[model samples]
Target: MTGITDFTVKGADGGSVSLADYAGQVLLIVNTASKCGFTPQYAGLEALHRDYAERGFAVLAFPCNQFGAQEPGDAAEIASFCSLTYDVTFPVFARVDVNGGSADPLFDRLKADAPGVLGTKAIKWNFTKFLVDRAGHTVARHAPTTKPEDLRAEIEALL
Candidate 1:
């Protein structure tokens, strides 16, 4: 019965970040890549974060290089890209592997809690998003093609 709060992730600064600190908030956890085709979605994600933050909503981004080496930058480089390109205010975590044996524990749990299309647990691409409710339950799994703006309704429901 473990939920997201049971995990710890690395911050952009490479420090440990406890998921428990986000208790009572609705979260959109995304696997991102700086050089991917879907990289522009960061703007939409930031929009969602800005529009709903006061309502206890957040967008937690985790950069990953597993997808075609799309995110090859180091921590500082990734942070700089996010800030300069998208003006992202939400938390952008340290680089992590979102698939295979080296995947981050948090991402592994998320995929398990909300499997992809046809019950497949494997993530297809970068920008894949997992929506979590206030109780830390993963409510839905969104494909990379699912735009952030399209999630407003669901986010509102959770709020």
Candidate 2:
């Protein structure tokens, strides 16, 4: 019965961030990578964050290097890339492993709550998004190919 609110994640500044801080907000938790083919999604994600933030929506970015070493930068580098490249204003968390034994606990719960296609729990690639409701429960899992702009309808529904 554990939800995302039960987990704690680290911010890009290496500080602890409680998911509880985001209570009552719809969250689009995305696994990001600066050098991946989906890297441009950062702009779309930023757009969503800006467009719906006042409506209690947020885009939480978590950079990961687990996918083909696509995100090999450190915290500073990741933050800089996000800022300089996409002007991302959303919360970009510390890099984390989104799959395998070393995966972050938050990701573990997310994948379990909303498994991938065909009931597979393994994340297929970066930019994979997990949408969480206001109550911190994961609602849906979007594939790497799913563009952020295409998620407006679902986000509006949750709002």
Candidate 3:
């Protein structure tokens, strides 16, 4: 019975925020890394957030260090890097393990709801994205190689 709105994520400032706060909004949840090869995807993500946020869409980023230690920085450093490097305005939560035993519960639910290629649920790498509809059901899963901008049509369709 668990859905996206039933989950809560740690805010960048260390407080807990329920996904329900984003109720009625389409969500694009991403596992992000500061120094990864896909780091530049932040710009595209930010663009999406800017373009559709007012129209009931949002981009929620969760920094993950589980891959090659690409995101070794603490919350402050990660926030600074995201702001300075990509001018990101969307929510970027505290670092989380997107895979393995220590994975965040929200991500666990995301993967379970929208399994990736061949029904595999574990996120293969950072930048992996899950699209959720307004009612909090995960609709699709995108691989790390999928660019943020490339999902515009899907997002628009949901809108």
Per-residue lDDT value at 144 in model 1: 99
Overall lDDT per candidate, in order of appearance: 0.95, 0.94, 0.94
Work out the TM-score per prediction.
0.98, 0.98, 0.98
By summed lDDT, which 10 consecutive residues of candidate 3 come out lowest? Answer: 1-10
Root-mean-square deviation of each candidate, in angstroms? Answer: 0.6, 0.7, 0.7
Candidate 1 lDDT over 41-113, as tens digits, reads 9999999999999999999999999989999999999999999999999999999998899999998999999
- Show where candidate 1 strays beyond 4 Å: none
lDDT (tens digit, per residue) of candidate 2 on 46-149:
99999999999999999999889999999999999999999999999999998999999999899999999899999989999999999889999999999999
The alpha-carbon deviation from the true structure for residue 117 of candidate 1, after best TM-score superposition, in angstroms, is 1.0
Per-candidate clash tally: 0, 0, 0
lDDT ranking of the models: 1, 2, 3
Question: Residue 56 lDDT in model 3?
Answer: 99
Clashing pairs in 2: none
For the record, the alpha-carbon RMSD of candidate 2 to the native fold, in angstroms, is 0.7
Looking at model 2, residue 56 earns an lDDT score of: 98
In candidate 2, clashing pairs total 0
